[model samples]
Target chain A: MHRRLALATAATLCGALALTACGSSGSGSDAAGPAAGPVKLTFWSWTPNMDKVAAIWNAAHPDIQVSVQKQASGDDLVTKTITAAKAGNAPDLLQAEYQALPTLVSNDVLADIAKQTAGTKDRFAAGVWQQVTLGSDAVYAVPEDTAPLALYYRQDLFQQYGLKVPTTWAEFADAARQLKQKDPAKALTTFSANDSGLFAGLAQQAGAKWWTSSGETWKVGIDDAAGKKVADFWGGLVKEGAIDNQPMYTPAWSKALNDGSQIAWVSAVWAPGVFTSSAPDTKGKWAIAPLPQWNAGESVTGSWGGSTTGVTTGAAKAGHADAAAQFATWLNTDPEAVAALVKEAGIYPAATAAQSGGALAAAPEFFANQPDFYTQAAAIAKNTAPAAWGPNVNVAYSTFKDAFGKAAQEKGDFSAALTAMQQATVADLKKNGFKTEG
Target chain B: MSTTLTDRRRTAPAPGTTPGDAVAPPRRTAWIPTLVLLLGAVYCLIPILWVVMASTKSSGELFTTFTFAPGSGLLDNLAELSHYRDGVYWQWMANSALYAGAGALLSAALSGVTGYALAKYRFRGRTAIFNILLAGVLMPPITLAVPQYLLMAQAGLADSYWSVLLPSIVSPYGIYLARIYAAAAIPDEVVEAARVDGAKEFRLFRSVALPMMVPGLVTVFLFQFVAIWNNFLLPYIMLGDDHKFPVTVGLYSLLQQGANAPALYTLVITGALLSVIPLILLFVGLQRFWRIDLLSGAVKS
Candidate 1:
């Protein structure tokens, strides 16, 4: 027994010492290695399609090997990319969301894609290219996917209620009220509190741009009349029995959908297939409609989030930079590759050629064989304005999301929420060294 | 025999329950322990139940339906996940297994030797050495990971399996646990007896002492295995290569993509479910070896 104690005690101390040494070993290596090897291109992307794109690229061009690393989320990609840039060894190419493009562009992290691809403005969808453009001169990245907002409702639920598909915001609200009055357990519309990106989409639909630059001056408009109107509209929905008191991050919303408590959701082009596919039993029962607008001629169309490919300025090897651009173009525009990508990742291609063609018109049979989804999607694209998101968008959106939730769920004062949002927006813009208009 | 002993012990009256028990209780009811167990079981099972339900969902139903409602997409999800990038999920599982299994084995071995030496030997600066090793337990993992990443980059080893595994092999907590266990379980007289029998120090440890410490070492091995398997921040910061990524990182990337796509949320949920299976199985199988009272045992000895 004494012998056993000694051995056990000895092993305990040994393990502790080893763990300590292990801890130190992770901290000691800091020297950068001499650059070498085949034009090694490290591309950071959050797209599922990038995995396939990498496979195809690797198979075709063994000499110019592209290694695709998946990032955690939208904010994660931005955070990781920034860290990599600060560390002095960024990836050769990165796919940042269109909203984050302004920040990357202002920081000079992205190479001028416009410099490489002449007539890029003409080649892609006008609205998409316009979204990426900061001013008359600097184009930071090229948009690869477009997300157009629409209302995704359970058609069976609508039929059961004897409700006509609402075209106006008022009608939609009334229908929602009826649905709630008929069944207090169910909500008319639901938005995720965890996702601030929804607010960005809503703001766009209301003809409010978060930031519009007049030369060097930044006009902060998140507190504008249009933005306030959108907030009030949504706030009213939650205040009434029109919406659920749950955020998108909660398990309650997912539960509500499965249990038939939440009828419809305001979604993007990518939402319908995702929602139905998640609950395959709901297939053939779901249908799509153009999102309800506050007024006729006011676009129901708005972008949620989509990726744009940019060349990294600090890449170790510029050898694959051109090839990377070519590969990106091929992924977006090349007919076969775009369709293959759509099939793989469900990302709607940003290219007009890809959007106009048979692949989209075929209409994924998953949506109750909805034959005109592309037409509906195309209509949204056509109606969507060239909305501007400032460099401080990420900060602004989160601040607005919090304030909106307070007003929507907590039944707090709307005007006070607007004031709070405006105050925070200006503070963040000034903090980030942008010249905010008083 | 041990199984029956454990079973009997589990049914025994609480320390403060019986009339002759050392401690006194409020004596509200005899149902408290069972209630507490049920509460713990519920707390643990809720997430597990969610995973079981979630893994059955398709990409669409994941968001549209309620979270706990079971869907008919389990096989479809598994098939799709298996088909994702030529079954990269399996590759991640394999990489995770290799990292955790090999890394834990190496950690336990190193911890055994170092812990034994620290506990038994009368060396210079013994207290200081032990204190310094103990100090490692206090240092936050991030402080170590950041510098470790820089160092790996310097060695041109960042993004490689060694970058993750080599750093993980030397576990400070593992060593500490082993030391306390070694001091409590192994007797010094046995070492002297082996020496009198004409055995070398290493042989004495290898033959007589190790056999006695088997139970403690198994506990250490399991602890290290679980620690390495659940590690996300270390591997996330260190690895850039997707092929080299563990399951946690893979699922994170999947979830992030789901922000725009929303379809990948199901994949992420399914992946998370799949990742927990091996660890759950291992825990269920090796739970008997858990000696959680090792630290207090040191104090008592």
Candidate 2:
């Protein structure tokens, strides 16, 4: 029995060591084998939309196979990429978010795809090109989609409440107030109290940039006059009960969106896809309108969120790096493919040439026959303020979100919250070694 | 002597026997304990229930209808999740099994040997070694994971399975439990008898003392199994290849996509449901060996 138990223990330990050895040896062998294939490109994307990309690639290029490793959201993608890079086994292609561009660039994990694609900017929208560009020259990402916020409302509810589609923010606020009075149980608009999404949208309309630069210094204008004005207006609207302050992932939020408890949603061009996907039962009840602006002839168009693709610095092969860049560019700028993504995946094309295709021209009747949806979004995209989004954007956003949560739930002072966030934001940026201008 | 040992194990007084009276108080809280257990079970099962129900629905039916209402897309969602990247989900599951199964086995064995030494022998640095091992338990995994990654990178082993399994095999809590179990269960007399019968120390430990430690080692195995199975950070930090991901990381990446493309929610839910199978099977199969008495003192009968 003693001999048997000792042998079992040794055997188990040896087995563990052997497994580790086998794993190491296998990875070593995989290193020498055709890293590309049989031409298998390891593509990591953090969206279900990646399914569409995979399908498109599979349908066309059987020989040049693209294997997509799905990751959830940009947050997950960022975490996974960092982990993979640390591990010395990063995927060749990474689907990165536009806001996270600075972090990826500063971390030096991304390859400069600009050198690979000479003069590829001509095919992409102006805003898309501007967003993908860092400091004045280096391009870190190839733009995949552009989303300009639009008002998605229930036309049936609008007619019931005697509300015409308000083209301006003031008129929209007025209409919202009347609707709130008409039914005390519901609000005219619903805004996530903690989210800077609406504020970002408003700032874009006012042509305010989040960050500005003068060759060497980076200045954050988040608490600037235009932003403050926009913040105060929204703060006033919240006090008036024109909107419902709700959390994003709550059951109540989902219910409100579906049952007409909330009548309108201000979202991006890609958001319609989410809506159809989220609440399919409310199919014919929705219509799309160009986002209501604070002023007529002014563009209130701003990016709520967008994603791009980049090659990791830890890529196994240099040739694979070129392939990744090629794939990213093709996915972003290919006219036929971009249209397919827009038409099928509902990703609004960031590529200028793709936006003119039949896919963008054909409006889904489910969205209340909004024929000029892409055109309006294009106009918004053109006027979007070119801000130098810093690496601290996510950290600042989370800090402000917490303060927003406190104010909304705990009924704390909004001004105090904003002031605290401003201070914390400056401290965070300074700590990260980013030269910040007060 | 055997009867005396059994008597010592029974702490509960017989029913109808009190200090001076003819009747005794009940040892267990009958209805109250049962009620509390039921409530605990319900609380643990709610999120699991939601995942199971949600996995059955199409993305369209996910948030549009009642949350708990079952839909008809379980097989469809599974099919899609399976076909995602030529069935990478199964690869993650296999990797998780490798990490948890092999990790737990090695962990239990190491704990047994180290624990037997600490319990049976009086050594110069035993207390210090035990204390150092215990201190490892208090250190947050995140604090270690970052440095571990950096260290692995230096060794050029960061992305491999060794990065995950090596760190897991050295579980401090497993060693601590093994020590306590060894001290209580393995008798010095039994070791002496085996030595007198001409067995060496290692043979004595294997033949006589090991059987006594079986119940405790089983507990260590289960504990490490669950720890490795549910581990997200170590694998999340150490591996970049989606093929090498554990189910937790796989499900997390799937959910991230669902955030932008809500249609993937079905896949995330279905994938989460699929990930829990091995763990459930492990717990059920080895449950008899999970003697709660080992936590207090190893049962010797």
Candidate 3:
């Protein structure tokens, strides 16, 4: 029995070691195989309901087959994509968030789409298109979806408090005060203590660019006058107790939204779905309007989260950039594809054609049948100034979130936090081997 | 003897009952200890109960409804989960079973051999080897995992099942348990007698020591099984193919999607609930060995 046990144990160890040897050898053979086996291309994306987009694309193009692998969202997706690209195992086409483009560009993992594909520049909303371009001429990705900021207010709360929808920052602050006075338990909405992206969006609307390039040298001004100006506006409101300070995406925040403890939310185009989904009973109790202006008559708007489809340098090595680039552009801007993203995935499309006429253009039931709410969103997407997120935006954004909270609590003393963030960003850029200009 | 220990279990001192907190045996009623055990069990079970009730809620109803209230969406949730990615949840379930079942079995057998050898033999560097093996437990899993990924990538095994399965086989904690159990369970006299009867070293161990060690080794197997079954970070860092992922990583990916599209929350909740059922069943099923061993000193070395 002991002899038999010894032999079995020895055999198992040998088998395992042999299996390891086989696995190590097998990984290299797949990448070197011929490109003729049905031209199967793997596409990675986090956007839900992309099976519809793949199905539509597959039916038209029989020679090139595409498979969409949904990944985790945001920074996680960026980490996975860059690592896989470094490993030479990345997908042919990948969906990147608009903010990740600068990092992806610096990592040298993206293909220049304009150089690879045909005329596709006129397909997207202008501001959305600007987000994917490097410097001026190098287009790195096709804009898939955009988030133009807007105000979603509770109509019932507005009526109960006898307040008009505030159009300008001054009027909005005044309305905020009046509403807070009416109910000490209520505020206009919660200022997210954790979202620096929102502050960046506000700064973008105020014409502050966090990163820009002059010739070859990158310039970073994280705490510039524009950022401070925008920060001071929101900081003063927060300090005055006009807005509640609550973390977004928490159970408490959802409870506040559901129970009408909060009266409004300044959100991008995609946030309405979350509000309606989380608080379905509030259907027809809410209404949409343009973002309250920074200046009384000015119409500038900021954006939050959006994504783009980009061809990677890994795909370039496979010698299928033309086909991949065509698929990338078509996935975002094509009428049927954009419709799939909008209707099935609940994504706000970046394509002007899809945005112009759609089921979305009709009055939404959640917003009390507001006609032309989406039209206002589409209008905001055009001619709005785009911010240049630096290559280190991911790190900078997280650090900025911490500093923004401190600044908001400092009673309009935002300049200190802005300066802190600027110095920190400059230090990080220099550490990462970038020549930075103040 | 086993019955006496079980009957004395009320006075066996509860998990957190320290030496200083001990009460005289004659001072406390049996009810006090029973209540304390029941409290511990309930504390462990409430989250599971909440998950069961929460999985039945629709996305909107999740926030609005009382947490413990069972909603009407159970069948809807099950149907949606089955249809999601063509029932990829089942694939994750199967992958988890493959990793845990196969991994624990191999680990238990190897632990049995090395643990018996360490306990019964006094070879050179035996203490050094044993101590080195024990030190592996001190290394954080992430520190091990990152280096494992880089090494696996270089080996061209980064995304393979073997990448997860191979690393899982070496459980230092399991081996430690096995060593202690072997020493306590097997008698030196039995081994000497087996050798006098002309039994080979392997035969002596196989016929005498292994059977006596089954219940204790079962504890080792269960530990490794649970450890591998719920492992998240290693597979998350290693595997690219969702098809190869264990349920934890799979559910994590699902939850990540839930962050952007909140409607996916119901599926994530349902998936989390379903994932727990197998582990609960496993714990309940394999707990008999622990009960048997703890009831009596089943074997002695």
Candidate 4:
């Protein structure tokens, strides 16, 4: 019965895909001229309180009114937006992650708004700006926020355990082993297999380019030297039982953080928000530091989560692209709007100007002990290594989760899991009819 | 009906053993079967029990305490859920009620008429039409959601309430069940007798066949109501505006606010707990209709 259901579902989905292809081809004729009333643009976002931020824009720009339609975030939203675009019913504006830009672009869902957003490029970091441009002249989106990797540790617990803050990978591993020796009941931290983005970020910090394209052909390097080094290091830790191998974002993980069974988290700038709810009892005891370096003196880090606002092709077809791009630029770069985004939505603004002062000068309430939290985060955000994303990032990420999840459970070889991820990603890319290179 | 009667009589207690069985202590209990059933019940109810217990805990105590231990944060969670975006959770609840209630009614009505025609009429192509519906019954509704969404977009009805409602109104399984029930419960001789008396076909169906099919149609209605109430993918894909979203999609949006914000687990659990109340009430209130025998005294066998 279950097999029959699965087959029927696959057939129906294929039928829908064929229908969407036919439907999209008939509706590309551009609608000319300005509207008789305000140019109403629909914006889809998953950020909390975005409606309030849009309201701030709405009160000022009566000419181009933007309405925010909140959506569930992550890879599913990327698919939803692409499907909506195929049906020619896509919203005018979209909040897409940095990695999703390539997929959206390849699908013809995003519009090139470089002409309108040209002047705002200086407002954001070069690395952050490059993500939206995709190393091309056409700008597909404006950077909204950036989540630079960092290390968060329990301050009092570190003092109690007589451990110093680690500055390099070697010291970090030694600390994990030392803590396990001191108290077998606790761990220095966990190596979570459930989060592929974390591993990808770690790889990026070690200068791995997972995806790179030249002309029309794509190259995938998921099992490159940097990626193998990072995976092997954590795999060794799990094998030795120096760190917990359980996944994060579970109830047990939350308990570990709350009760100090885990004293440190290798996370991003958004860790405080998570700690606020997941480990509310340990709020004031935590402090942030730069991610431990691959080399002893390196200052470079990598990003785990961030988003960009893009104008969709549907807006361009409806002749609302200019207004949409204007709003997108303002939403990211305008000081007032960025501050509202920071205050209302709790996002770490990607625009370099908004990273330090004004809305970010004060620490989050949950991190009240770290008075210069934003200042420290800004320093880490400066050296984020450039990340390469492809049109099939979703496939790569899912494969990473599955392969690494099993490997972590058995304390098995992670290099083998990485090879599996690499093969699956390459196979999917070829199946999608993309030209590929080794 | 006569075969069922004989089977019941054959299964009845033998005449000589009745008095002894009634006066004696109960036969040895089926320990293994009882244990298996108890285990099944526990397996089914533990998740619900977890939800109930987890809904009462504050975020701090939620994962730290014992799995089944109840905390003192239920009221706080309720207030927060109610205050979330000016009670948008209630809006979702109301939307779900509207979709499920109205969609089920319309579906039941359509199924009744279609099933009656299919069972009673001898028109050409009736067999083919029924066969097509059978194929549709085999096809899972989940698979058709994307195609239906594309069609709705073509009609300029995407993101509207009708997009969700219209697709839900044409359940093939409901129509199939209704047809089978009508064929079994309604006697052809009575319809012929009503027709011979010069009664119109519509009146004959309304006055005679419809009343007999009420019990079966009630079953159809309840099935459709629950299906539409719990449906997630259809409404999630159809509706863009959060105001039009059903509770399933609304709770999903709460849980997936992005990587920066933690999921609102307490409020979602509380909302889930509250949402099931209406379903329970509905099941309890409408269960009496299910007891009406489909063919009770409808024909002489």
lDDT of 4 by residue, B69-155 (tens): 999999999999999988999999999999999999988887887788778776555676678788888999889888888777776
Candidate 4 on A282-320: residue-level lDDT in tens?
Answer: 979999999999888899999998999999999998889
Model 3 clashes, total count:
3
TM-score of 1: 0.83
lDDT tens readout by residue for model 3, A1-438 = 455445544433433343344336544513554356656777877777786689899999998888877666768668766766676667788888888998988887788878764577777656777789856788899988877777889988899899999988788889889988889898888777587777778788888989987766789977778888877777778888888766677767787889898878888777767877678777777777778887787888888877888998877777778878989878886777888887778787777788766756675556646677677777766745686787888878777777767666555466677787888888888898888776
Candidate 2 residue lDDT tens string, A1-438: 456455544433443333334334333313534553445677777655565666686677765567776655655457556655655556777877777777776666777777876788887766667777875587777887666677878888999988988888887888789888899787766657655655565566666666666665667767766666666666667766777767654556766777788888877766666666665667778877777787786655676777787877755344566666777777777766676666655666677666654677766555645666566666656666554476666766776788766776654455566666667777887887778886
Ten contiguous residues with the weakest lDDT in model 3 chain A: A11-20
In order of DockQ, best first, we have 4, 1, 3, 2
- The list of candidate 2 runs beyond 4 A from truth reads A1-42, A49-67, A79-90, A315-323, A339-346, A364-382, A410-416, B1-42, B48-61, B64-88, B121-124, B298-301
lDDT-sorted candidate list, best first:
4, 3, 1, 2
Q: What DockQ does each candidate score versus the true complex, computed on alpha carbons?
A: 0.35, 0.28, 0.33, 0.38
Which candidate number has the best lDDT?
A: 4
CAPRI-style quality class for the chain A–B interface of candidate 4: acceptable
- TM-score of the first chain alone, every candidate: 0.87, 0.86, 0.92, 0.93
Ranked by TM-score, the better of candidates 1 and 2 is 2
Write model 3 residue lDDT over B202-283, tens digit each, in one string: 7788899999989878887888888899898788777877788898888777766522355477888999898878888987
Candidates' C-alpha lDDT: 0.73, 0.71, 0.77, 0.88
Cα distance off (Å), candidate 4, residue A370? 1.4
Tens digits of lDDT, candidate 1, A1-438: 457446545554444443344334433222333246545577787777677767786787766677787766566567556655655556778888888888776776777666566666776766678877776576667778888778888888998988778887888888988888888877877745556677767778888877788988888877788878876776777766578756764545666665667778787888765554344556666777888888865655777777777887665244455766766666666677777767777788787677755567667666746877787787777776556877877777677678767776786565567668778978988887888797
What ranking of all candidate models by TM-score puts the best one first? 4, 3, 2, 1
